[model samples]
Target chain A: MDSSSLLSRVRVVLCRPSHPGNIGAAARAMKTMGLSRLVLVAPRRFPDAEAAARASGAVDVLERAVVVETLAEALAGTVVSVAFTTRSRTYVQPFRTPEESAREVLQALQAAPDTQAALVFGNETNGLANEEVWQCAFPATIPANPEYSSLNLAAAVQVACYVLARTCEAFSPQAGAIADAPDFVPVSHEAVEGLIAQWLAVLERLDFYDPAAPKRLEARLRRLLARTRLERAELDILRGMLKAVARKIP
Target chain B: MDSSSLLSRVRVVLCRPSHPGNIGAAARAMKTMGLSRLVLVAPRRFPDAEAAARASGAVDVLERAVVVETLAEALAGTVVSVAFTTRSRTYVQPFRTPEESAREVLQALQAAPDTQAALVFGNETNGLANEEVWQCAFPATIPANPEYSSLNLAAAVQVACYVLARTCEAFSPQAGAIADAPDFVPVSHEAVEGLIAQWLAVLERLDFYDPAAPKRLEARLRRLLARTRLERAELDILRGMLKAVARKIP
Candidate 1:
């Protein structure tokens, strides 16, 4: 479960796969991307000759896959559980993309290095049911053709693996040249709000806010600042500049 | 639409989507990520009441989506077409991860100032079929759990948009604060290849190859050089060194 170790970092969990071919293809896809850990939850048919044949040289992955009866058992020890859902269920929480989910997973891994994480995929027929999605902390969805949004189960695994691999590659330990000198620390939401409030006060003092002038002025300011992604230091500087301007106004 | 005006742009394309709720969720995903453009190709059911209700507040993306019958139509006039696939199709060439694909898309947009570009996703049942994947210039595949790789469609779009947004945010128009004064242009790929070949001849004369050594040596050399991403001036210096070594060998 060590975040630093490549193994035990991520576990791919399929709720219930109907086709053996998908399991095989999923294995192949995982191997191609340098990922091997796989877990199946009550597969309709696994260890089938067809799946083994389709798996190519990834038979090892198939051999090592854990078969469990329920999702709860599969995710028992995992710190983060991300459910893959195609539709937004009435009661299920909203979704994030695999990339965003990966970031979250990475953060969780860093925060609690011993906790394992699982990215769960549902059955082939209906996908992870609403109940399954609700069990997870968040749902991740793949955007597909609105007319025909049916992606093969294995393909979903491939996408998730690709995200993890790329993330690992982009921020590889060897590529940690910037780690020593962190240029900008992200400003917390509270800090950003404080800056905004300060700016608003200055604007109010200068009579900049015209009640009837615009409907979305505050909203626009929020959007603009969100896009900037200012660092804490940068926000502090802006606050100082605003205070200086306020002093001059007197 | 002018691609330049679409700077820091994001286009959300859905292919063969079956559930209307998914379409709505996709719109919500786009809106959350600050992406406005949404395109749909041959959706099974759209503008469904369920989709609008699920969209929460991102109805604008749904209302504005450009619906088309075919993937080709959706990608018309696009300078760069990136197909998001989870399965490795027999027909299409190797795929890049979302990050690499996004980099290419951004680069293509910058290179061809006015050209339109698109990121296409496939159906839910079967991601961009093999033929569809081949139509794209760049193929992006996500990495998932090998055992059960089922990712919800909207999540794929979210990942794509997230990478695009981050790339746009990270891009620095200017090279460095203290731009290196214009120096000798770097040698092109062809020039580098020629220099490497000449260096190989010198090594050959020095008995550096023991019949099987050249292959390994060349691979190591390629890996070392590829890491540098050498500019014109840097390449010139390397070529000059190679030429000097080659002359001395005689």
Candidate 2:
């Protein structure tokens, strides 16, 4: 699916949110990843100062967020519903990384452009209840250290968006310039190694290596050479030098 | 390279942001991925109520965050620095996904674990200044849609840490577990260089260099050994064999 449809058609659902600040922070997170649609399920507080203030520059996202009374209401129109959970459930459900889920979401959207997908986040403390988890199609988990895997609400939103953004191939601090010039690539590693080998031959032939009482000089020299990051043209010029010196010697 | 040292040896720096809440959110994002070191460079407003409120339960992250006057100060002592950008500059640069950059960072750390690496983010609006991007070694760009790619500051941090965490081998949603397991680490570049020098002496004594018409054989040999990624113990064993062989030379 095209980027516009995938981004515009996806919805972020926060179920029974307890905090005004988390709602605001989550709004900011959603906007950063190019997500516009936000659905809140029975939030304790709506349009609160803390939520708006927490959104920072993304106040528009808070203003645009859709408020609903239940998780079912939020999931009503979405073609797919993905829930973020910490615990391993009794009944096994297939869990996919955000990247994989994003692909699936996009593919589903591609097949049905009018339909949408929902990324659901549970309440701060109770998390998504068994009934809430049962409503979602995919159970997703962020791979964090299990000992202290209690990820904050908005941070989870940020990671989910990040993975989605990466999977969908979205934004940059500045990306267009890099995208326009793909041919200007670095010298291949193989070429760099070859040039270094040539230089080594010349140095050794010039009697640079001292067999007896050899100090750390050669290693230091190698390090110095590595620093220059010799390009392809530079490598050719140095290779020419090697040929010249080789002919000059016996 | 182990996951423990890599996370500890990396710093996340946000430079000259206009919002205090973004800084707070960015801090919380870092902690979720097991990253703690945060350095702020000349933010417009800090020690702010909005930032603390946005940080949620991660107030400790804000409490421990380092505020600095310049990006250089934040970058001081870091062995490598990477900058995130959206647009490409006049001269082309090497851009890699956060996953790839993390591996390179880990490899560098394995060579010198005591040293640190820095990932720098630009201000909220201007993104990173061209001069700021120049200060970094790798110019990283997250692929987002060009039409409206303005990502939230903390979301970018989340994506970066998420990619890094995946490469270092998954969760301590708490850390310190991997920090204790430092055995079987990569040998330092200096150590590798020293080993090459010792072997060169051995090869010369063995008449492998052909004293009259020595070619680029030594350089080729060095390049080949460099590819092996000699571990510390491997270097020691090779050095011991070199010494033993050198003693047998007539």
User: What's the TM-score of every candidate structure?
Assistant: 0.43, 0.67
Quote the B-chain TM-score, candidate 2: 0.67
lDDT of each: 0.64, 0.71
Clashes of each: 51, 19
Give the CAPRI class of candidate 2: incorrect
Q: What 10-residue stretch in candidate 1 chain A is worst by lDDT?
A: A172-181
Q: Is the docking of candidate 1 incorrect, acceptable, medium or high quality?
A: incorrect
lDDT of 2 at A154: 84
**What is candidate 1's local distance difference test score?**
0.64
Per-model chain A TM = 0.64, 0.73
- Model 1: chain A TM-score against the true structure: 0.64
Compared with the true structure, model 1 gives a TM-score of 0.43
Off by over 4 Å in 2: A48-64, A88-91, A111-113, A170-250, B43-53, B88-91, B172-250
